[model samples]
Target chain A: MSGGLTLVVALPLLAALILILLSRLERRKGAIAGPGFFQRNGVAVGLYLAVAVGFWAFFIIVLPQLAMVDLSFRPKLPPSQMGGPKDIFTLENYRYFLFGSTTSTANWNWLHIKAFFLSIGVSILITLLNLAICYPLAFHMAQSAPVARLRVLLLLLIIPYWVNEILRAFAFRVLLSSGGVVNKLLMGGGLLDAPIDFLGNDVGLYMGLSYAYLLMMIFPLYNAIESLDRNQIEAARDLGAPWWHIHAFVVMPHAKPGIASGCTLVFMLSAGALAAPLVLGGPRTLWFTPIVYDRFYQAFNWPQGAAYALILLFACIVFVLAVLRMFRLSLGEIAR
Target chain B: MAAAVELEGVNVTFGDFVAVRDANLTIEPGEFFSFLGPSGCGKTTLLRTISAFIEPTRGTVRIGGRDMKGIGPNKRPTALIFQNLALFPMMTVAENIGYGLRVRGVPRHERDEKVKNLLIQIALPEHGHKLVSELSGGQRQRVAIARALAVEPSVLLLDEPLSALDLKLRQHMRAELRAIQKRVGITFIYITHDQGEALTMSDRIAVMNAGVIEQVGNGRSVYAEPRTPFVASFVGENNAIRGRITQAANGTATLDTPIGPLTGRNPVGLPAGDEALIFVRPEALKLGGDPPSGFEGEALDVTYEGSITHVTMRVRTGQKITLSLGGGAAGILPQPGDMLKVGFEPQDGLLLARPERS
Candidate 1:
């Protein structure tokens, strides 16, 4: 309902409309080699653009987003009590998220804010951890291994990812539990006097999330690193560069787009993940998705849930944009 | 400060496959040495062993009289310009050239100064700020060479670095590379499958085949007096005549071939009744010759190639022999299907024992 939000949604639509009008005008003016896919493939590209804009944009993205925005700006009411004169569109849900509920009497609620920041911070940490864990493995799989061994390694990496994420997280849950294998092994080795509380805190959740998206982080890196000419590395070595320098100056810069892509994907997914947190996190661990879950299911507050979900989506978008900027890459480059 | 390279009985094998077998070579300092062969001839493998990229399976490699048994490529007094050039596309031309200096902890000011001087050396002085991807293929090649030379290695190993360039640029670079090597006065070991490049650029050429070095000599010697059948067949085009030695006398063999009796210098000196092959350059055979011996055949085809006319003839026994005559020999030009007499001086023909069929 705000002018800013309206403009944010309308800017892309306006650009698309301008492009379509210009293309039509150019078509009427006569055939010319202008910069448009429509000019190249003729009516087929126009038909493709029409289908994409008409069906996918409307049904998948724009319509659902509009519905969410509408829901977020409305009053929450039961079905029997809905559509009454008293039930009016309001900013109560957004206000309730920013401040506290009416009974709290606080100027601004810190719990939701703290939870959002904590989730974002930890998601970033998990993304970084995944990058560290997957980079060397990806490099080894892509370059160091023989072709036959590389196939076996790729199969091992891919096969684990084929298991559902939730099941994988539960498996982590079992391993990270107090009486789990990790703790037993540690205790048996006399490294610890007592069982560590991995799941009781968010440690288990972080590990589970990083492990759950390990393949997503590895594949993009593998594809990028694989394209690097092995001769470059050997040339660097022959030029008297140490191994670390070779990676720092040659390999890492080459894999930047993949790193950005993997980080963005892992950050977005982990930030919005619900199951890992629910399964592996303790009651005190207040991840933002659990709050959204609480609002929609437990408190039966659809508007508040929509508000939280939209805010999380916006945060993820900002993160992706920031990462793209930091890596000096476009979405197109990352997609490659 | 150039260094000589010595490979003493070096053998490199990977699993069950022998890449280089019993190689012994000594490359004098400041000499342009080239390994000439077809692909999979182990020329590149031999070069890598000298550069210490791969350790020899059996013997030792020495550079400037220092044993190179345990030295890696980084510590060796040599740098390799890869076959692909391998210019770091992410770096600017100056950065790519300065990388060797930078890694050695050289100060930025010194590195930049050296890089600027190297840009001039490669004749791309204005393109230092440009990325490697922006340069033409030949320019990238120069940058790669300059980058390797920046480290001041006493020996430079080049692995077919000119293979990617177009023909004209490749020929042009052959002169430029030789000039640079001479200016630097470093031992240059070049690898290439193209014999033209090897012959034109190298001070000495080692002809290799099937993991074995068949012969090592100057370009003229290798071409004029090849010791092995493979070298004679590989180094240049030759007209091969198979025969059995009927008489051996004073380093000359008289062979009874399908084309008729022929006498030539016999290096292998197979005894009487032994199978042999005599090879003669196309230019050595001439039309309407009558001394020692000659072959009478029907002229099958005549191809005029600028300064010379190549004539293909089939003798009565049904073997093809090709001869090149001077283009100005218009009066002597034989038309196709006409009977022609072609003969060569006994000294121009080289006779060797027949190579066993694989």
Candidate 2:
């Protein structure tokens, strides 16, 4: 592709590797925080600073050198003669979304607009759904049950994750197809008059997508909930807080990290989710990932695809960082 | 007036294992009662039964002259401060203190007023707004107390609450807990495995072992006139001397043994033919020149323990007996293998029935 695109991917990888290597080093090295990082085998601390600096440095190199083409004119075709003669530094591509203006289109207008809006909607939807389903489940799984009961349930939760993620997604695909068990049951039980669209629809997309990523939302929430001291609940109970009051005042506040992490996980996964939504959502749901995919693979528009992909990658990083910030989790803090 | 609690024939069995069996005791209202024993001695099991955490497998638990059948922990008029001091960490000091009142639907203003009073009662009037996490270990302990007391239960149950503190802090908290109990004037059922703690704080102490109450009386009575060998040995340190009875009469028993005729006070219910153990409190045993009328012995070893010198001596029967002598005692210090005489009054020596399989 372009030098800017190459640097965007390579810089973080190189930095992470170097940071990891520095972790194995003695206190004398000057790779990162010098004494602070090198003295300790604090791999996570090293990685965090390395990743943050790497992202910042990569952005410095790419943002100025990258080409931004304005396609708000009549022609919806990409010109072969682009990013060569004109200035590399342009804010026109960003301005279209942030500040809509009067302009002429001369590029692939429909693809960019569709990809941008779809990514936003999908990310928001997934985050909300994950919050809805996982919050109480994690809370219940953590606090509500007696110790003996939750022990077995936790084993059940820990089991499926061991079976692998892709297998779980593919299993959802089988369940949501037109002639799958769900549709058959619906028709057989007279819940539906006829077999309607199950696979390759929004319903299928949500079902498959949520199922595949629920564990990601669940484990962190469970850990947060599990770590909450029961003394807090008993204290609430002693304080004359009814059951609900205890949950609202005592349990929820401590679980802020779990909630943030769960939301962030679903947002990151669903935004660029290629497999489940692709398999279940079919052709109509052109996610931003696949849009980038088409340019890179089908149209051979590597530079343009890299640009869009960089935007998606950058957004994920910002969203994750924002959540981490809210929870007061530094790179070191969020480490397992 | 009805007793605050009457546990009659209370037996708690976990499957084949008996935690507490045939426990019978009556705790008068406002009495500072303690169940003291070594670990796994079922003292805590009895305490838990009284608190309604574990239902007695048999017998009756009575409170206010009412049988406490099917009365769960929350339903019972008792506030149990768990061993771990399960204070809610998410709440502030005042919030924790007012928890009991709040749960009882007491209004916020009333809860606040009561919590304020409790904070003062706990000697921390200014800590109400502070988070529990901010409090020191001792402060957290006080907060746990204030919260339990805020419930205003007629009976307060403490399950080894002072076990977590360091030795010096534990000693301080022990005094503080006793003072608080006295101020509140409620029936405090304290459970501990510490003998010294029980003797110091308890109005009446019940010494339990192997799911049964070995002996129950005031601390002095349990310590002085231990009815069984278990009570005598377990309640406090005592030198046990084994001898067979030769002459038995009213309040006097002469045990015929190798050490010559050893005189001991007759504890009631000891038959003449029954094999008995003579228990002598350490300080009571006198070691010097002439032994009492019919006693003679040779000093084996003497160990100085700052306050007292522990003397070990062998009598004519070849059995060695130990005694605690005060450091300031005006006498030649007995050395190892030195020939001397040791004697004790009959009141100081008690004959105990053999231990019953525990």
Candidate 3:
């Protein structure tokens, strides 16, 4: 029965992937048909590449996700009684996410639902914050900065990313703690009478998540803005547009695709983030992923965890679609 | 709102490299002026200084008799059309044309009306609804011009705006741009490396070399009476004879050359024994003339260009001299290796001190 269900879900996904590939190939048919991949790189080498990509896509990505989807719809039965009379397909796991189990006293799982929504809301805030920080920096690097200054700025931005993500998160924790260097400086400088509760209010988490994915936002914005003609900005200025007006009317409109791609990347990554939340989240902060994490490992509720994971994945897909619609951008444009 | 532009000892330098130096000129109100030079000759820099994009390193830029030292480009009453047109690709043609008004907080209906009128003026009435990318090259050029003119600036600065078009379209735009300038009656400061573009469109042309404005005069005067050797060679095609001045009297000088002593008008009053170059246009040199200033050479190449035939000949001293024959005058064309006599009247040639560097 699970095998049948897997096939039903997998076939459409396979068809969609094939259609995308075919359309892309058809668009480049003239160039491809002239020399062709197999002809240019020997047939043996082409086959090897094809087989390797097929193996990675099916086994590493598609099969694992399919297995999780299949698991989410089934009951969590004992190993000895697996696939037996009591082990059947059900929605109890997903229902437990919205309303507590029948035995629970509460009518709804308000804590978990609140956490889920809060996680999404906070991720959005982080994405906006990243955009605000990256846009000007990217614009400066791409348009106004000298080549030497741009090189130095690029090196500074990239060097910090060489550290492991978890280590970076931990470093943020150290910096944001009550007795951290930040608080010490604030106190010594007479800017604060006491250390601010950066970690207790989730400020550290937001800062950590924003810093973690900054490069994701900057590079795309820089790439898009760099392709814009410098004369467009000059023309605007020559036409009596002030600096901010020029950016609002000309530069921002041109960077829409970059903004869309950057927002999607930062939002998706911030929503699914584990290391940053685990290290920098305050005791009061309850993120959705931690709940999903507890179900999978601590509580050993694999079915419920898979169901929650799928729900989060669905929400992310909806967010991506909403962003695309809002920006009036196609996936192909963002891909560029 | 036409205004006179005065640049007094304007100098612009980037660190040690001087882009434009000691430029002093007055552009009369509503005059169509042009800065003509080859690439890297500081014409664009001078235009930028006048437009307030670059502040002159040491001078006063007075627009309408007001000192415009620290004003930004937006604050200045000048509009610039970039070389590439620089139309906003994301905006419709109407929006691109009306962007200046929009920036100034003009009402929507009024801005739309103005944009519509501009579109009609540029002969792009139907293209207002289309994106900039959807228009053809010539349409985009017109849209850029309309965008600049929409601001109704006192001065319009153009930086080789027609360079991207083909020959046919460039010629057409030249007339269209000149008509627009005349109709508006504003100070038009045009910058171009194409001598034809400058000569055909501008009321007066300032020829620049390196960082110096060598000569400023009307097209006829600049071409017929160039004050410097750079202007003489740069303004038109000329056969340059390098020699030493042997005699300087009155307004003419005799140059002792490899072939013979050639005499021409000395506008610069070069003294005897000074190195000099005499330039004579190809059309000035006639065929089979028994003039005192004449040379006999073997024809090396003959190119028939419909209305005119150019005969390239090598003199005995191995110097090449080109003489052009009018369409009907060259009934019997000279072939390769045929001996030809090329001559030009003394008054038709110009002699000036040789430039420090070629």
Candidate 4:
């Protein structure tokens, strides 16, 4: 890969090594009371570090990312001149996507950048909509419902997802089709003069993406709100706080970690989503993932597709950081 | 600004179970009243009824002579300190204390000023900026109390607010709570299963048992003249002897007992031949003393606690009686199997008709 990719992969591993060494030193010096983590777990810290480093940090994450970074930095070569100068390492693909290449008359296309931003925006919008829809539903499920009822509701919510995601997207396409039940009902109710083209617009894709990941948002919120002490709400009420104030001041603050995590999951998943957009989107929709797919499969440009995927990955990380910062939550809290 | 809280025939039922039944009591204005009972005895339910958290199934709850029916907890003129204190962990001490003011739309400057004064009142002025989690158990207890008081409610309700503290801190906070109540001069209705706490802090106490208020009186009255056998047994350690009332007169009844006839003052005045039980406090019973009447027993155990020596003895009737004697009894410590003579004045023992056990 490139030097930047190498550094990115090495940095976290180095930090983990430093932590392990420091903790080991502290144990030998008896500076801390308890046994070191590895000793307490009855295994050497190195073994645990090996499992984390070999299985997770390297093989699962860094290796695949490094391969992609390598592919992204290379230039596209034709089949006839497979090992030609065009195959050399270059930033041409990234440059093309970010600033658009000079044509016969060097004009800014702005298509790729606009698509990138639009997808990010739609992802954020979906995240927010899911939050607004799920918070109350989750709170009711976790706090008010009896155990058996909660289980039944959770089962009902999850049973739909047992079907494949692609199949689910196709189901949405059928449901939102011009001659489908939704349009038929609207027309039957005299709410529409003509059947609207749902799949030909942004609305169908956004709705499908949100529905695909709705459980990802609800479970975290349910787990967090469930753990909150009900007495806090009662105490707030006893202190003269109204319903809105109680939720604003007490409930939301206590659920920050869950909110952060749920938003992160939904944002990341929706931003990188391909199946829903593929099934439900029309010419009007220009999702970033479709562009990446066109580059790799249709146009036969692996380097450019890799670059696009890398950019989307980095954007997802930035979004997660922004969410954590906005909520004043730490990674440790989200990890819980 | 204190208000009298009166519950007239208040009853709380959850589905098929009755939590608080026919609770009738009047808490005088500015009075430090307590509901003392074991777990699930409806003390907390009664407190919640007054706080408007739980509406009574029957009758009316009146605060300051105004009916509080249909009033939500927030709209009611009462604040409750939960058992866990329930201080907002996310908020600073000042913010927790001032939450009520903020909810009432008080200006920031006014809220800050009131929060500052409450911090001093709670003796945590420097810790106002610290989160509730940062405070010690006693500090959290004080903060919860200050938070409840900040709203300037006519009634302050506390539900075992000191139960989480250690023994020393719980004892200390008892005096602190009573002092704060005096300073605020608001009707403080505290709930606790700890009888010692109720006896130490309350102006009057209502001892509840099985969804019923067995007795309501001041600490001294409840301890010295319990009207019911439940009150006499639950309030403190009491030695009881089952007997039949052979002779009933004026206010005293002579009970025919297993260990011979015993005479004591009877407030219930059960007729002759009615089943009765006589109760005597450990402190009221004396050992190694000449008295009007005495019993012979063998000392089974002797425990020395700081200021008192507790002697557990087995009487001729196989009844276990405990005697709490002053430190002076240290010199005359009764060993196991030692012959012991213990007796009490007739007025010290109370005779009550035992209600048939369900």
Pick the lDDT winner.
3
TM-score for chain B in model 4: 0.95
TM-score of chain B of each: 0.96, 0.92, 0.97, 0.95
User: Could you say which candidate leads in DockQ?
Assistant: 3
Residue-level lDDT tens digits of model 3 in A117-152: 999999999999999999999999999999999999
Q: Quote each prediction's TM-score.
A: 0.92, 0.79, 0.94, 0.94
Of candidates 3 and 1, the better by lDDT: 3
iRMSD in angstroms, per model: 0.6, 3.3, 0.6, 0.6
- Ranked by DockQ, top first: 3, 4, 1, 2
The sequence of per-residue lDDT tens digits that candidate 1 reaches over residues A54-171 is 5555557877899899899888888887778757889888888789798997788889989999999999999999999999999998899999999898888789878898898889
Global lDDT for candidate 4? 0.88
For residue A314, model 1's alpha carbon misses the true position, in angstroms, by 1.3
Q: Write down the C-alpha DockQ for each prediction.
A: 0.79, 0.29, 0.84, 0.81
Q: Which of candidates 2 and 3 reaches a greater DockQ?
A: 3
Show where candidate 1 strays beyond 4 Å.
Answer: A1-49, A77-91, A102-105, A188-191, B1-3
What tens digits encode model 3's per-residue C-alpha lDDT throughout B1-358? Answer: 4248998999999999999989999899889999999999999999889888888999999999889999999989999999998899999999999999999999999999999999999988888999999999999998988999899998899999999999999999899899998999988999999999999999999999989999999999999999887888889888899999999999999999887888899987889999999999999988885876887899999999989998899998898888888986668889999998778899988898887875
Judged by TM-score relative to the true structure, which candidate is superior, 1 or 3? 3
lDDT, candidate 3, at A265:
98
lDDT digits (tens) for residues B1-358 of candidate 4: 3348988999999999999889888889999999999999999988889888888999899999899999899999899999888888899999999999999999999999999998887878899889888888888888888888899999889899888788998888888888988898999999999999999999999999999998999999998889988999999999988899998999888888887677789887778999999888899888867775567899999888979988899988888989999987777778999998888888887898877981
Runs in model 4 deviating more than 4 A are: A1-33, A43-49, A79-86, A99-101, A104-106, B1-3, B288-292, B305-307, B327-332
Specify the CAPRI tier of model 2. Answer: acceptable
Report lDDT (Cα) of residue B66, candidate 3.
88
